[model samples]
Target chain A: MVSNIEWTTKEREVAQEIFDRAYERETGALVEEIRDKASLIAKLEDVWQLHDYLSAKRHNIDGKYDFRDAYLVFVFSQLVKEGWVELNELEDLSQDKLKKISALTRM
Target chain B: MVSNIEWTTKEREVAQEIFDRAYERETGALVEEIRDKASLIAKLEDVWQLHDYLSAKRHNIDGKYDFRDAYLVFVFSQLVKEGWVELNELEDLSQDKLKKISALTRM
Candidate 1:
C-alpha cells in the first residue's frame, strides 16, 4: 500500500532553507518589494499555522512534516491561485487525486 | 507588582478579530496587492510562529495571547522598521525600557 506523503526529509530541508533565506531577506528595510505580499504570507501562515496546530496535537516532526500529502495539496492550491506554482492543465483535481499527488513526495 | 504581560483577553480578541479579518481578505487573488509583503508576513509569521512555539511550549491561549510582553516587543521592533508602527522618538530604548512599554498594554 502506498503512503499518503510525498515530500522527503531532503525536500523539507530544501524548502526550509529556501523559506528561511526568504524570511531573512524580507525582514529588513527591503520588505516592501516582495510579491503577492498578503496572500503569500497568508498562505505561508496557513502552512505554518497548520504546522503549529498539528505540532501541538503531536503530529509534526520538529516543525517539518511530509508536504506531498494533504499539506502540500493545500499549499499547491494556494500557490497555484497566486501563480507561484502550477496546477495540472488536464484535469480538475479531486480530493483523492490530490491525496495521490501528496503520495509523490513521501520518503 | 506589575505583571510583564499587558494585553488582556479583550485586546487579544480584538487583535484576533483584526488579524482574522486581515487574514481572510488576503488569502485570495488580492494577495499580491498587500504592502510590505515579505516583511509583514515574516513579522506575522514571527507572531503566529511565536504563538505556535509558545503554545507548543504550552504558553498560548486559543491561538491568542498577551501582546504587550516580550512577543509584542519583538513584534514592535519588527513593525517599526517597516513603518507599520513607530518607536519612541526621544529615547533610545533599553531592553528594560521596552519591558516597561510592554507593561502599558496589560489588563
Candidate 2:
C-alpha cells in the first residue's frame, strides 16, 4: 500500500527530513501540556490551520517536495503509528473505494 | 494550557472510547496503502472530511462526549506522541498566543 502513492523520491526525502526534525523534539512535554481539553483543542486547531495552508499552497518545482504533502504524510504516518485510524479499513481499498467510503462517512 | 479548554469528563471518556476502538484496528495496513502521493492525499482528504463532520455535529446532552473534540484530541495526542509538533512551543502559549503563531505559519 505504501508503494501505491505518487510521492517522488525527492518528496520522500523531504518528508524524511521533516520527520527527523519532529523527532528531535521532546514530545513528552507536549503530551504533558495537553493533559486538559482546552490545550488539546488549541493544538488541534493549530494543526488544522497548518493543514489548510498546505492544502492551498501550489508547488512549482517538478519532482520537488510539496511541503503540504510531506506534512500530511508526516502527520498521517504518526496517526497510523499511534493507532488513531484503522489500517485494514484503509488498505486494499482503491482511491475510488476510499472516496466512496469517505462519502458515506460524510454528514 | 490543557486545562484552559472546556472538555468535560464525559468528553474525555468519549475520546478514550474512540481511541480504544481505533487501537483495535491494524493501522499498519492503512499505512502500507498510503505509500504514494495520490493515496496519501486521498487518505488525508478522507480524514479532513471526517474532521469537518465531527466539527459540525452538536451534542445536546450535558457533559456528554463531543465526538468532534474527542476525535481531535485523539489525533492530536498521536501527533504529539510521534513528535510531529513541538510541545515546548505549545505548552506555555495561551490560546491567543497559539493563534498568533498559527497566523504566522499560515500562507
Candidate 3:
C-alpha cells in the first residue's frame, strides 16, 4: 500500500541515487525498484535478515537455532498450519526428516 | 516445538532419504540437521517460502508485492517492532530509504 509516487524532488533524487548504487553494487539488484522508502527498506531488511538466518540455520545440528528461534516461529507456524508437518505426533525429528518433506513438496 | 527423536527405523529411514536428496541437490544446505521430522519439515518450508518470497520481492518494482503481500506483513511488523523503520512517520519512502537503512545497518 505504501507508494512513493508523491516524493519531493530532493527525496526522489536521493532515492534514485540509491537505486543507481544498487545497480552498481548489485547488493539488491533483484528488488531495486520500489514505490516508497518504507517498503523498500522493509524488503531490504527481509532479504538481509533472511540471508543471515538461513546461513546460520543451515549449519545448526541441534535444531535449536532454526526450530526454536523466536523469529522463525511464524514461519514454523505457517508450515504446521499448512499440514506440511504432523501436529498430533510432534516428536523431535532425526537428522533425516528433511528428505521426506522435500520429496513431498517437489512432487 | 516438534521433534522426532523417537521415530521408528522405518520413519527415520524415510526421513533420511529426504535429507540425502537435499544435500545432493543443495536445495536447503543451510538449515539442515534438525532433531526431528516435524521440526525439519517446518524449517524446510520456512526456507522454501522465504526463498520464493524473497526472489519475488527482490524483483518487484512498485513495492506492491513485497510490502503488501500478506506473508510479509509479519516481516514488516517485525521491522517496525525492532524500530528499524519509522512507525509514527509512516510515509511512502522513495528508493533512497534503502541506502539510508543499509548505511545504518552496515555501521
lDDT of 2 by residue, B1-107 (tens): 43245555765565455444443232332223222221223233443443343333211111222345424443434433444444343544345434533443442
Model 3, TM vs. native: 0.17
Could you tell me which 10 consecutive residues in candidate 2 chain B have the lowest summed lDDT?
A: B57-66
List model 3 lDDT by residue over A12-107, tens digit each: 354344334333332222222211211323333444455454445444312322322232323223344444333332223322233332333343
- TM-score of model 1 (CA atoms): 0.21
Rank ordering of all candidates by DockQ, starting from the highest: 1, 2, 3
Instruction: List clashing residue pairs in candidate 1.
Output: A5-A106, A6-A105, A6-A106, A7-A105, A7-A106, A36-B32, A68-A102, B6-B105, B6-B106
List the TM-score for candidate 2's chain B: 0.26
Evaluated against the true structure, the overall lDDT of model 1 is: 0.41
Model 1, position A92, has a per-residue lDDT of: 43
Write the residue-wise lDDT of candidate 2 on A1-107 in tens digits: 43244555665565455444443232332223222221223333343443343334212111123245424443534434444434343544345434433443442
lDDT of 3 at A5: 20
CA shift at B29, candidate 2, in angstroms? 46
What's model 1's lDDT at A74?
45
